[model samples]
Target: MRKSYLKLFGLACMLTIVSCSLDDDRVNFQYTPLQITGASLPDTFELGRVYTVDVNILRPDDCTLLDQFDVRRSFTDTTQIRTISAVGIVLDKDECAALNDSLQDAFQFEVLYTKPYIFRFYTSDDSEGEPEFLEIEVPVKE
Candidate 1:
């Protein structure tokens, strides 16, 4: 019984040494997130006329990418909201990892009715983190 106990202890020590030597060499990094600093849109709009809004974003670094762009319109009552139509930006993997750290992209959409509409810009990063938004009011005129 004593010999068996010694063998078990010796095996356990060898396993521990082997495990300690198998450390990973890869480094993990936490990057700064992308932020929507501000937005620019027309103070008023005419019904059926298309308008463009320029959205300014502050990126962390060149490696940061714009994962998604969701432009939505809502009412002041907070009971109705609808997504505005936009030609989705198609970018390759290389293009997404751009060298620039800031961007001013334009989103085009039209309004059908005149009221107090709230325009919201929802953006995400390549890291798939929670999105940041820029909300503004664009009143439609008759």
Candidate 2:
């Protein structure tokens, strides 16, 4: 009877392993290759005014944060631009998570001058894939 009980236990363990692996085909969602589904900015912005802007980041699953940002300036027109480094802007991770899309993302920026600038933000997962980013134009006036 002892030998029979041991055999039953081993069979049960094997069945459990097989059953779990059988669901491997379920979705197989990956977090890489993130996309920015939305970008929001005010139609009119004034110099030295703090403003809240948002970008909707999307992933196949809900498992990442909006990581970093870059600022640039358009020289003659929107076509030609250069990256401008400055501070006073931050990523609101908590707010991003509460917004639309699988992953939430938005940035709060304080305008330093009355000039047009380009803002870029990046997002990624912990495991893999190249960084994905989005850029928005901030047109400021005096």
TM-score of each: 0.50, 0.42
For TM-score, the strongest prediction is 1
lDDT of 2 by residue, 1-142 (tens): 9999999999999999877866454433222334555567787678888887665655432334344435554565443233322122233233333333454455577777555776555544236755544556767778
Task: Go through the candidates in order and give the clash count of each.
Answer: 0, 1
Q: Could you list the CA RMSD of all candidates, in the order they appear?
A: 10.8, 12.7
Write the residue-wise lDDT of candidate 1 on 1-142 in tens digits.
9999999999999999888854576433333334566777788878888877676765644545455455454555532344332223233234345354666777677777766567655545346655545567777778
- The window of 10 residues in a row where model 2 has the poorest summed lDDT is 84-93
Q: Please, what is the whole-model Cα lDDT of each candidate in the order they appear?
A: 0.59, 0.54
List ranges where model 2 is wrong by over 4 Å.
Answer: 1-33, 62-101, 121-135
Cα error of candidate 2 at position 12, Å: 43
Candidate 1 residue 27 Cα shift, in angstroms, is 17
Question: Candidate 1 regions off by >4 Å?
Answer: 1-33, 73-100, 122-133
